[model samples]
Target chain A: MSTFVGLYNYWIVIVLMMAGLYTVIAKGNLVKKVIGLNLFQTSVILFYVGMGKVEGGTAPILVHGDGAEEVVYSNPLPHVLMLTAIVVGIATTAVALALVVRLNEAYDSIEEDEILEQDPTT
Target chain B: MIAENLPVLPIVLPILAAPLCVILHRPRLAWPLAVAVAWATFGVCCALLARVLADGTISYQLGNWAPPFGIEFRVDSLNAWLMPLVSGVGALVLTYAPRSLAAEVARSRHGLLYGVYLLSMTGLLGMTVTGDAFNVFVFLEISSLSTYALVSMGPDRRSLMAGFRYLIMGAIGGTFFLIGVGLLYMKTGTLNMADLAERLPAVKDSRTVLAGLGFLATGLSLKIALFPLHLWLPSAYTFAPSAVTAFLAATATKVSVYIVLRFFFTIAGVGESLGNGAVREAIMLLALVGIFVASLVACFQQEVKRALAYSSVAQIGYILVGVTMLTVDGMTGALVHVFNHALMKGGLFMVLGCVVARVGGSRLSDLRGIGRRMPLTAIAFVIGGLGMIGVPATVGFVSKWYLVLGALEAGLWHVAAMMLVSSLLAVVYVWRVVEVMYFQEPEDAPEIDEAKTDEAPFGMLLPTLVMIGATIWFGLDTDLTVDVARRTAAMLLGGGS
Candidate 1:
């Protein structure tokens, strides 16, 4: 039963990773690429959060008289790390999306190839 | 309070300044504030480096939480050396940005440009000083995102395309790095670098560890723009605003190289049998290819910026070669070159910026006969060009000298020969620019404007000349940089391999 659940979780993560990677590689629009980057980063967060799970575990916070506890606790470190990563990921996406908006305004197009084609120096 | 807070100051000061710059909402105020913040960060880094040098190592736990649990900022001889390089360059670049920003960037957007520049500077410095493995990825993205923004600010439309390409590539690299870090976490159940280094040895031969290493090396190579993977660099540098190009060219990939060194040598445990003779040899071969092919390509470029961009790729090859040698001397060469290349390339690109400001472009043809017009600027360019070509008594020469010696020590005579051949190729590219600027008459020679003949504004020219002077100064008196690099190399090599 546990193996089945674990396998399902892994499958979901694999799909998320593949989806994010595909968008990053295939999308020509700069905004879409940043969205793809966010998606890619999010999948890693999901993977870490998944790994931190302990079946039937309570919060990692230690309570009084909890020595030799009846219930196991989820490892909280990955979740904490993910929180920092999530913040960073958001910052990156924000900055990247901002750049995309500026690029659109500057070049009058968000499409990558259009900008390249219209470049005067090239 | 100061002792407890020192570790986080390098990242926090600039991080806070970014929002402050935005709130101020005026370019004039933002420029001075950013410069002041950058210098403060540089001072903080210097203090941090001095502390690490004196104390051996300093570890700071965020929120007073103990590590393996909380995020850590660990400073040792390795990162202690790098902190100054990143922050010092940040301060120098900001000093030059005020006037250059006025000329190239639109006035309305100036505040935003300086804000992003400050953020990028904060991010790069943070990446170097953070001891948490996952934190490196976070800071990497911080710098990468801002870089795409900064690059897009170039007046030419091509800058948009260049920024776009760089964004795509940088995102892919960042994602790969994330995956690598995730795999390591899955295997070791820890994210702190010191904890991982402690744990990695036990799993040195494990498939998970090997896969993580593979992912990390590929990701970082892309970030460093190593050889064939460097497709986005030339265009990005060529089209980006001159100040932006100079700042990024000087420090960005060098910081990435620092990451590569940290992961491979420190976190991965350099003495692990899994990372043995065969792997080192393969890396060396790739470095050699990068050196020869990139230099040869650089020699034929007509645009001065594009040529320098390719030259940067070749210089990265030299650093990789130093790493591949795996000896103390070799690593020292690589570390010193990291500093030397920053000085020379920063100066060289600033010179190009001056030329761009004066003549309105960076094409080889436009620069013809400008040497007679702008003698000081042209002379500075020549000195920087010669430094790039590794003339004696320049910083570039010191780096190549150590690299050659490193190769010979490893009994790689053929590698040493390749280094010499690549230096000759550098001479070819350097000579192309010199001959154009000095030899050929200006296309419209008769109609000379006296105002244009004067050097760039004192602010712009002063920074360029200072960097040029540093390149020559460090080359002649290598004592300080050499000592720091030697200690850094020893630290990375795990107390003398």
Candidate 2:
């Protein structure tokens, strides 16, 4: 029970990852699939943020002075990396949505099955 | 100063030019700018490869920020070989693109297309140069997103569907890679690849590391389009503008293969805690299956581009099989194929592009009597086909020679036999196109003009022939590609880190 509680953040991560994966695989609507991908990416972001948190740690602001005591601060690198990842995620979403919009204009529908029915080769 | 900045130049030049292209606002201006920058990047790559060959590995800190803390651009013989191939292919295809894009993409959007093409090339080159794990994901998305846009620029609605599918799958692959990098960082507290390599061994036994490896392998396999994960590739190749197809077929998947080599052999040092034999055996099994299945599938494709796209999947299998051997000769074979496959496949796609430009379609039926109508282009296709079949005196034969030698060195007789048989499968598909082009009469091919010779324009033909010429040149002169590949294989197996 202690171990379960201790790893609760990880458990949430796994659950979210699975839900996202399932939605991506099962959803036929292209927009819903993009949302699924967002969920999938959000889980990874959560994982990074969770891993960066230290017990009672503060932000990684450097202190200066003769009396400045050593403070336990959370690792900032993962957070910084995920910030780039968030931007990448947004870019990916934008490209995907733009592609979706074009696909809809061409096919008159965003349903994969409907689009494929219209052009079997696709 | 220029020599010192070699490691970053190939990546920096193109990315800097990408925005300049859009700002230029006219393709007449943008196209020339793109070509000049691409050639400059290739020249820089050649110089970098020469330096790496002479001085050993060169590492540059981005903004002079020392690594483990700042991003590093590291170049060894491995990436030195790849950088030239990527930039060289970009140069060739960009030189050939204006006419091709003029036909396929809209006139008003040509400037934007050139911008996106440069961004895609930048992303691939950046992925090749970076020594940081997270940086790989960043560059991968940059390339993948631009690639989706480029594919959608194809004339038909199918291209739109193809591009959308690729975006979805490629995003998933990129995210998986990000998750893998995050896992590694959680355990090691560093993103620098070399630093991660050094620290990984201490935590080698951890479940986190194993999970990271799993994620990395799966994600890279998707990106590389290795066998089962390759569903996005065929249509993506089939429907993209001819120039985009040629550029991507030659470079994109090969870069992913190089990354796999980096992660498994360099960072993880697969001979250690990675269960080398088990992992190698699994890859070997899949590669063998992929070679047989994809080759057979290629034999049935009606569209010439689709046939070659399936053949690309089979060729990737050949590269992976060589990688699994884990011998110097085997890795050498894989590296050589990485170079050789680009020449042959890029040349073949250019040949198809020529046919598409002239005939307006690449279906087998459309190619009837093409040998008579466009003798030079048809003959180029035949030569490219011969290379695919691993015929002697061609680049494909050279790579396969090293591959078979490697398999035999590893005492994998059956794997070597399967490889030989798959080359015969290539003959079937190539023959199908050859027969249609040469033997069948052009009376049925309404698109083929019977009045005068319709060879591809001098600009397109020159690049296509140059690529085909390199195929034969590299095949005969084993001194360059083979020597570099041998040293690279030695370095990789000697723990390249």
Candidate 3:
């Protein structure tokens, strides 16, 4: 029970990841697939953020001038890395959504089944 | 001073220049700028490779920040060899792109296309040069996102569908890589690959490490389009504009294969879990199956470009087979084929680009009697096809020789037999195209004047001829390609430089 409690955030991440992957695989709607992709990426962000949290820690700041005191701080690097990851997620989502827009214009529908019916060689 | 900055220059030059094309929005100005940047980057890459051969591994600290903290650009024998190939192909494609782009892409969007091309090259070069694990993910997405846009720029509406599918698959693959990197970081608290390699051995037996390895392998295999994960590749390559196909067929997946080698051999050490038993057998089996299945499928394609796209999948199988063997000779074969396949495949796609420009379609019937109509282009295609079939005195034969030797050295006689059978399948596909082009009568042969030869423009034909010439030149003289591959493989398995 203690182990389960300790890894609860990881468990949540796994659940969200599987849900996103399932939606991506099962759904034929392109928009919904994009949403699923975002969900999958967001779960990774959550994993990193959760892993960076410390038991008894504050923001990673150095109190230097006069009141310098030793402080336990959460790791900040993972959060910083997650910021880059977030930007990449947005770029990928943008390209994917743009492709969806063009695909809709070309196929007259965003549904994969409808698009395939229109004689896409793929 | 310039020599000190060579490692980062290949990536930096184009990335900085990419946005300029978008900002200028002048196609004429943009094309020249992109060409100059590509050739300049190629020169830098060549210089860097020479420097590495003479001196050793060069690691450049970004902003003078140390490792395990800030990012670094690392060049060893392996990546130093690859950098030139990426930029060299970029330079040649840019030279061949003008007439081809005008034919397929719209006039207004040429600037945007060149910008994306440079961005893709920058991303591929960044993946080759960077030492940071997170940096690889960043560059992978950069390349992948641009690649989707490039594919979608094709005149065919189906290209949009193909691009969307590639985008979806690529996102999943990249996110998987990110998760793997994150897991590695969680266990070790470092994103530097060298540092990760040093620390990974301590937790090699941990479930976290195993899970990380699993995720990384699956993610990279998706990117490499290995067998079952290759659903996105054939359509993407077939539907993309011919120039984009030529550039990407030469470079993109090869970079992904490089990443697999870097992670498994360099960072992860390929020891207990990765090197033996199920993982090795699974990859080897997939590669062998991929070779036979994709080659057999290639024999049936109606569209010539689609057939070559399937053939690309089969060639990737040969490269992976060499990699999975884990012997120096095997690795040499893999690396050598990476160079050879890029030359032959890039050259063949350029031939198709010429055919599509002249003949207006890439179907088998469309190319009927092309040998008599466009004799020069047809001859180039035949020579490239012969290279693909592993004919003697061609680069393909050189790599295949090394591969069979590697298999025999590993005492895998059946694998050697399987490889030979697959080469025969290559013969069938090449014969199909040859028969269509050379043997069949052109539907409009009599309507046109028989004396006048309708060849592709000199600009496109020259690049195709150069690629074909290099194919023969490198085949006869194994000094440059085989030597570097041998040294790189030796360095990798003897523990990475």
lDDT of 2 by residue, B291-398 (tens): 999999999999999999999999999999999998888889999999999999999999999988888899998898889899999989999999999999999999
> Model 3 chain A: which ten-residue window has the lowest total lDDT?
A62-71
Per-residue error (Å), model 2, residue B243: 0.5
Candidate 1 lDDT, B292-352, residue by residue in tens: 8888888888889999998999899999999888777888899999999998998899989
- Candidate 3: what lDDT? 0.91
RMSD of each: 2.6, 1.5, 1.3
Clashing pairs in 2: none
Return the lDDT, model 3, position B23. Answer: 88
What TM-score results for chain B in every one of the models? 0.97, 0.98, 0.99
* TM-score, every prediction: 0.93, 0.98, 0.98
* Candidate number with greatest DockQ: 2
RMSD of 2: 1.5
Ranking by DockQ: 2, 3, 1
Q: Looking at candidate 3, what is the lDDT of residue B444? A: 67
